[model samples]
Target: MSFASLLPAAVLFALSFRLAGAISAQTFAPPSKGPLVQTANYTSFSNNTLHNKHVVKGKVFDRIIQVWFENTDFATAISTPAFEQLTKQGLLLTNYNAVTHPSQPNYVSAIGGDFFGLQDDAMFHIPSNISTVVDLLEEKHISWATYQENMPENGYYGISYKAANYGNSSAKPYSYYVRKHNPLMVYDAVSQDPARLRNIRTFNDFANDVVNGTLPQWVFVTPNMVNDGHDTTIDYAASFLEYWLVPLLTDKRVNGDRTLILVTFDENETWEIQNNVFALALGGAVAKHLHGTTDDTLYTHYSSLSTVQANWCLGSLGRQDTNATVSNVFSFVAQKTGYKNVHVPANQAPQFNLSDVAPGPLNSDAYIPFAAPNLKARGAGGGPVFLRPGLNKTLTVEKLPPPVDLYSLKKAVPWQMSPRTTSGKNIIPCADSDCK
Candidate 1:
């Protein structure tokens, strides 16, 4: 008989506990939020919610939940009372910034690691040949989902959804949900898959998942326009946090089990500034010792992707996630993973305030065809980079030839239309199977 087989049951349990503790540094017995009320009507549209308790052990944390606000500058958000109060319970990220001005590109870049040079909040449909963090997460069998508030239905493709009777004034219809804010939907890689579309859920689904104790390993939460401060003030967004996030902070269903919750904004309202936005790291995964502390790592929206990649030891999208300067892993995760982060002196920090300056496949004025991932570039995860199918392996982003004329490329690629039409229509016509 093996020597290990002779151990007592209690001793084996203790040994297992120690090993688990080594993987997840901390655990919490958070208070429960009594039963939550489900108010949204889900009968009209498909509301397929996948309930998976599959736990993918990570080097630092098990699960990551991102809660994003909108367009509030750092100074304004930090000054808000509710925002200030939450900082006391979490780690405040001091130097975090958004990638660009306007909301859509930042949201897109957060998941896909690149915005493809998008500069506006107009509706865009990326080709299915492009892959996202979803592909990387799935490669490791890590469950992930996006919970959007006021999203009329699961994977609803409409440009926006206006509530029937809800608005500041009764005179105008209020569009609380916009497709631009739903990051994953912009990519055909996610939206085209029926199973993936089902995972794009509404707030009601989030409540149900929490109550049922079936929350996934990775989640992205986006509040509605008013609640996110896009069409309102930071005070309004703070109030929503108080009413929604404050109680949930202690709710074991939402915040426990080594789950790291990141509360951040998509971009700052002041385009003239450096796009610095207030961000906080909270939940059980954060060590109690680090609570109420501040981390001054130079992080951007792409850090979210890289941080997740590092946590789960997942592969890179080979986009900005591999950019050492901009997409540094979270300091806490980097410490555990031995990922060296670049330190940018404040004077030398890249100005992220400019929009529509860089050119890529999405920019009509300076169009470049979609290029494949850099197979040689490695991310914080240290896993083999993911190369999407149908991509020309020889046409890597680094080796791509000079930019082509927009008009000339448009003739060959009929689906390459600007996000907006001259008449202010946000919908780009569905020209191919890639577009919905």
Candidate 2:
């Protein structure tokens, strides 16, 4: 099909001349221009020099790493309470990346373990063969759902801005909750099953479900873009969390004894190649301020999913989860009332004298700099590494997955438009221009 053919059908679908006039005549201001924030600690997070020397040894130990992000960190400041939360509780992956740019693909990687060469919100449906961690949970009959804003029970639109009729809210208030937050459900093999699809609940319905003790085994929460801190402001997102999560945190059913909450960004906003995003772990399981210990391994979305899958005994999602080498970031050892006996291994405490290590504070905005190794060093599987003994004796340490030759996948189907909001009707037209 010619590119022109793909223009959204809104023009043709308008019911009348007046309706078209009402819709198309409305001119909207472009997204407000603002400085993109770099990582809060750019020097450390973006330091490719440090990333290149990285290797995974299971010895680093495992603990829950929940993350929350502000706008893309051009400033490189990791002073946020969320950053401190991850540092105190578990290992901070300073060199982590979302792999692909923009938003959707990164979320895809986080859930499905592969980017699949998507860069646009085409609403195109592609089969992700690799099972998601959700798949693992489902196989074991574990329940989970994406408590999405504006999404009805059956909403399936890929990505769009029409809040009333699109996948989520049009106010951009909850786009993050719908797009980046629901990766586990959107791209997983479980989504293919009607039973699983039925599990995806809308944002409005989530509170009552949790209150009634109907909380799923795993829960993915996404706030609107306006509130998610992904768009222009975090005030709404913070308010949303403070409003909902505070109660959930104290809930006997949801946060009772085993619940874990992770907050992380979809990707760095700068589109930089370094650690653009940070993760925060909180709940009964998280240790306090895990501060300076770095999990020095090549990581991205797949690695995150791989860790989740491994922890849940869910099999790998083919090549999507490249760095299943690391252990689960969540730990149950410290939970006050949430998951009990979840089997998080003890942290392998190693005292490394940091007096010898450079100590000036590295703002989260600094980028980790590194050029790629010679072509031979590049491949699908990442480079070889030593496993951390008992923590991951079963994993085979070999060359990592080959680098994706984007040129080769140019013809591949781009990411699709998120399905329509399922409030019993498709209330709005797709925001083709804005969404892309």
> Which number leads on lDDT?
1
How far does residue 364 in candidate 2 sit from its true spot (Å)? 33
Cα lDDT of model 2 by residue, 1-436, tens digit: 3212433465224223322342221122212121111121111111110011121212111222233344444123233333443355444554444554545556665655454444433344434433455655445455556655444334354553334312232534323334444564555355667656655555445544544445565666665555455544333334444444554555455553344466666666443234335554456543445434544343445545544444444444454353333222233221321212222222531211111121111101111111111223211222221111122222222423323332233322232334322122222344444442
Error of 2 at 360 (Å): 41
Clash totals, every prediction: 0, 104
Which numbered prediction scores highest in TM-score against the true structure? Answer: 1
